[model samples]
Target: MATLLGAGPGIVAAGARRTMTRCDGLASVSSSSHGIERVYLSAEHARVNRTVAGWMREIGMTTRVDAAGNLVGRLERATPSGAPDLDAPALVVGSHLDTVPDAGRYDGVVGVLMGLEAVRMLREPGPDGTGWRSPLPFALEVIAFADEEGTRFGRALLGSSAVAGAWDPGWWSLADDGGTTLHEAFVAFGLDPARVGEAARRPEELVGYLEAHIEQGPELDERGESLAVVSSIASARRFQIVVEGEARHAGGTPYDRRRDALLGASEAALAVERVCRAEHHVIGTVGRLETFPGAVNVVPGEARLSLDLRGELDDARDRVWRSIEREVDTIMGRRGLRWRSAEVHRAPAVFCAPLLQDVVREGIVSTLDRGVDDPATIFSRAGHDAMAIGAVTDVGMLFLRNPDGISHHPDEEVSAGDVARGTRALAEAVLQLAADRG
Candidate 1:
């Protein structure tokens, strides 16, 4: 495939060298992944946050922290002190900053890095004769959202929900493993919780929102494609199940007399698989487990499990839940154990704006020219900041295929060639959206 062409003269000229540089950048980002593994809670949390903010400031962009602790760096068409208020609707490119425990750096950092680098690249003097210039037509804002993993706080899209005005301030009282409330964290970050309401805006104010993220799936590698143009964000339904059973000494308890909660929970876990496997896009996983009165020689008295159910369609996703319900009923009837299931989360599938997806596709076709054999459009199982932002704007996403189909781990990777390809596509797409063709 020919190198991805850029909008400006001499942009493609540095493609080869830039490819190596991007590889180094990926290595640098991946290094943070290693650091995450070495530390508790992954110091990458603060490091990734600082790295992105540092990059933004290094380029002379003005920075601000919103009420929800969202980090925003702005590159205005005209400087704040020099030009009229950024009149035209603004373009926003962003992704989350928080990570799952021991997560790969590229999962969240790639989008932040790509957006920052694009702004940096565009800010450079244009070609040989064009002189000092910025390629962006509209004011561009790069945001590194505080939390999207729901990892530490048990709530996905915390920062984005605040920005979208969907979150209630009362939710800030929710605590984490450290017993720190989001409100407390906000204060520590020097942001005012009272101002969180100010983050929302009328939908028309944003031109478009774009995010480049890791695929987190094997579709690209399975199909031999380098990128995946996202069509829709998957729906997620999470639940917590608690099982009650009689506890007895492991040595004294007869197998038939044991009404073990862990035993019942195990059956439910297997049922989750049976249900999800019956459908095309459904995914059911039991990611967390806790035992009550934990002991090595005792029959488990109680067990709590967290179930994550996901799918591309609301109906299909719901079906998996129904299957789980039936399985739980059967297990209780047979085991004679009491159980209770509570809904933890339910986010419906969000479709990308067709026009925005088309624009991204055009960017890929124009820049990479990988041909039909390596077609790039596909569905994404992962959720993103764009899902919340999409509620208020025309939103789109670009996926850089993870080499090993690994994510949320220390070994995540996306090749430098892939980054270059993805960037060219994103840059071109941003240019198209920023242009006022109407």
Candidate 2:
């Protein structure tokens, strides 16, 4: 058996370099008009999956495309005596392959590629001439989930949710920018929508889910840490808010006599920020706003806006929303404007399992054996596939430092060294889990 010392920094660094090369190659296959935009079931999606499948096959994994269009690569575990054990529950590792419009090269891509690298490190012989020192007790499955960005269908986590048996039938009616229904796109992509349920796995089928992603925030960079353990994923809710008033000529109508919907909406947006600021770890944003009859001389009789609220706790997020709603009511009442809001999306916070957290902590400590005994635990303000997978099994997350805390854009980046550290940490975590299970 190979010693842990054989998979040291040098070997890990080589693996990370390979991972970066693969990510760059995949980035070139995007379908973005401005930047990187590989959405669900698009031609780019198929191309990337083909490339990833090739990589998986090279590592001796059996690859398949799930009914929900997720790309899966399976490496069955073997007994200590080298006998294959096909019935073992899988230790799944992965992240979404889809991207937002004009996205950066890392984000979810790093997790998927790093996962493959970790498996490779485990399977290859170490420098000490020992082989398969830490054979996993469970099968290892790497998944490149299909639609976490929701760029094409406007519903995130479609791939992971399908795997968790949370597929919603109404999603078929969702339309894309090109007026194509999701159901039509599924058929066009050669995916049988009728068999989506086949993608769902029972709780007993999985040992757990683990993901390694770039820190989409500045916390890790500020702390000067290369990796950290995720404590929980934030809860989030979205709403479409509308304000209504009478229309008139902007120049002719007196300011005192006019009931402007745009003015009311502007005040409501500000109130959202103010209310969110009062609560700890809660955030609210008005990301989109538009005025009807957008002529220079016409008064904006109607205004539409979007609200996104998120918090570390479900009750806290709900409280902030209620406060914002009250503020909106006051703003509209004084302006003689009517207001209405429609909920668009909602997701509750998901906490990592304590056992999984310990394993991740050990992995981080083992990789970076500095005086750093305690790994930083950060709460994720962004949603992830782990949230959906949490429904079926325990979930854990490891975050690598993103230099500028920038993500979802072209400037997003991670250091090759940090990627190397993250890869080693994840591989160690898997080994630790195997030891615990045995």
Candidate 3:
């Protein structure tokens, strides 16, 4: 299909070495933030601060770090009199930059890079040495939030919660693998640990929030779609279950005499799968398992397993959990094992606002109208920074098609054409929302 665009492509010079290295620099910066394993609350995360700050400077935006260490980069609106609006909080756009162990480079980084691209496209002057008028009405604030993965700190959405006023001060005391508190990491990074509240912004200060992300699921590619306007995020719950039984020597104990924790754990795992099958909108996975005394000649005395539960509805999540809890009790009674289950994490489903949903729809439709290919209807299985922002202001999400339908892995891939389409769609969405903010 012929590409449809309102304006001829503006001549965008590649950002100098610093700007060009945005991706490499971001990766390098993240690598240093926690010494190449920058988990949340790690001293290495501090390393990312300088890199982000430097890029904000090169991008011509004034940079500041919030109490939670969320970096906000502001670019004021050029008013009719050429006075930049200082009071306006501006339209915010960005995503987290942290990663899982050797995670795919594109997952969260693409969104931030796209936001930078929008800013770059907006900042370049037209052929006449005058800036082209922007289609969007609000000033843009590009952001690169920290610590969404929780791989190290074991708490997801740490930075965004602070920005949204949802993070508890007590959260600072939470420890990592090295027993280091989040607050101590903050102090080491030159931030005041006591003033995390300062990171909270009143709702009025935000005009809107936009995020572009990869389709972390196979829905888009499976359906042969190029992009998806996210309608809502699924609710997710995580649990850790431990089954205890008496350890017995393999040769000494007869098969009937064994009180094996591994056997009980296996039954519990299959029970989880069965419960999910019985309930629609419910998906359960047991991703990890550790058995005590994992010797070939020994029956395991204790087994610990992780459970991940997801549903499209709140009640569905509750129902699934209840089923699992019941199964755990039944399994323990039959196997003569002591068992316990603990909730590790819970994130409620989030619905994107109708107004912003319209913007996303308009953006996609506009792009297709301009001869962009077909888009898709999809929801995010993974959580996003926008979910927090959605609680505060108008928020929208754009999902680019993943060619491999895989993410959070090293082999994740997206076509360049798909990315370009996503970029145009995002730019169009921002412009439409900005221009029509009456």
Candidate 4:
């Protein structure tokens, strides 16, 4: 758990601040009207990749755009004699560069910039300025996954799924708001859709995948901690629920004669929250809701709502969803409304590998001196590319605190000091894995 790079906390903090500045600069290159919205295969996506590629090249890493349009950079391992060894299995570290519409700066960008900074720190000369502090036992690969937010195609993890060998050809037909199919967008971006499988990495070619990302929730901030080891990403299910009832004039409708769809939907949303709150580590949100004949003078004839349910365990999430469904049924029946739901998405929870979790803990311990008893372990409610990559290789995550626990919004923020600690922790993690392999 020794400090691998020999830099004191102050020096590492300064380095991380500079890297964060670069990430902030990249955040301005967005496609949205006001906030960041670099979707998959868009022009903004290309610009960010080019800028990140430049940064990667400065660290003496070879860079390429993978078939799936993911920006990839590799630093080969060095032999005892200081020669590069190309045959080594690589340890991959990265996060997505894509952001949700109107996203904050650090949600995904911090991890990529931090990975690059860690690699730069690794290649820096020793204190005496003569040689590297330690030779690498495996290659280091940094990936800026092309798409994680699913803002354009409504399908998350497209980039990581391709890398994990889970890409489905059916996704090519998926379209965006502008009517551009994913396949056409890939072509326009100079990527060959038919060759997307070329992006896949064999399990044997990788040691593992590590990601550093903002906690995107209140846990670490509430505890006054800046870092945590992620235990798992939550299992999630999404559904579109519709309630139908007879429309009536609001002024003419009496309590006994009214069948209000919006009222039933409102009750169902509350029921979802109640059911989710009754369980540990469960969350349910009705993020989008709409009513037919949107007017104050008329009782709603129909209501549509979106339900997103997540939990630390798959079965637990499913159970909560069932309870919510029953509640919705009862509310609709009482209101004389017909209700139906169509599932739109489902993702199983992915647990971190125990060995990699230990490495993450050691990294965190090596970076901080306070209360080394045990670092906080948290379950992530937000979806990440790690979930997709977990299909092929063991995946691990480091969560840095987000001030006010905000994400996917312009108000989301992370401190420079915390990012610096995260950077050092990530670098130390790579070193720890190298030592274990050696």
Per-candidate TM vs. native? 0.88, 0.97, 0.90, 0.96
For candidate 1, list the clashing residue pairs, or say none. Answer: none
1-438, model 3: which lDDT tens digit per residue?
222234334322332222335655555644433333456545556666667667667768898877887778888877678888788667888888778876766777777777776675566554645334453456788777888887867888888888887877667788777877887778876789878888877788988888888888888888777789988888999999999999889899987788899999999999999999999877899999999988988999999999999888879989989988898899889888999989988888888777777677776776565555446656777888887777778778899888768877767776655665666667667776765675
Task: Provide the global lDDT of candidate 1 against the true structure.
Answer: 0.74
lDDT of 2 by residue, 182-217 (tens): 999999999999999999999999999999999899
Q: How large is the C-alpha RMSD of every model relative to the true structure?
A: 3.8, 1.8, 3.3, 1.8
Q: What digit string (tens of lDDT, one per residue) describes model 4 on residues 260-300? A: 89989999989998898899999999999999998989999
Candidate 3 Cα deviation (angstroms), residue 152: 1.7
The worst-scoring run of ten residues by lDDT in candidate 2 lies at: 1-10
Off by over 4 Å in 1: 1-34, 37-50, 58-60, 78-85, 126-137, 370-374, 436-438
Model 3 scores a TM of 0.90
Error at 23, model 3, angstroms:
2.8
Report backbone clashes per prediction: 0, 0, 6, 0
Q: Rank order by lDDT, top first? A: 2, 4, 3, 1
Best by lDDT: 2
Please list the C-alpha lDDT of all candidates, in the order they appear.
0.74, 0.91, 0.75, 0.90
Who is ahead in lDDT, 3 or 4? 4
The lDDT of model 3 is 0.75
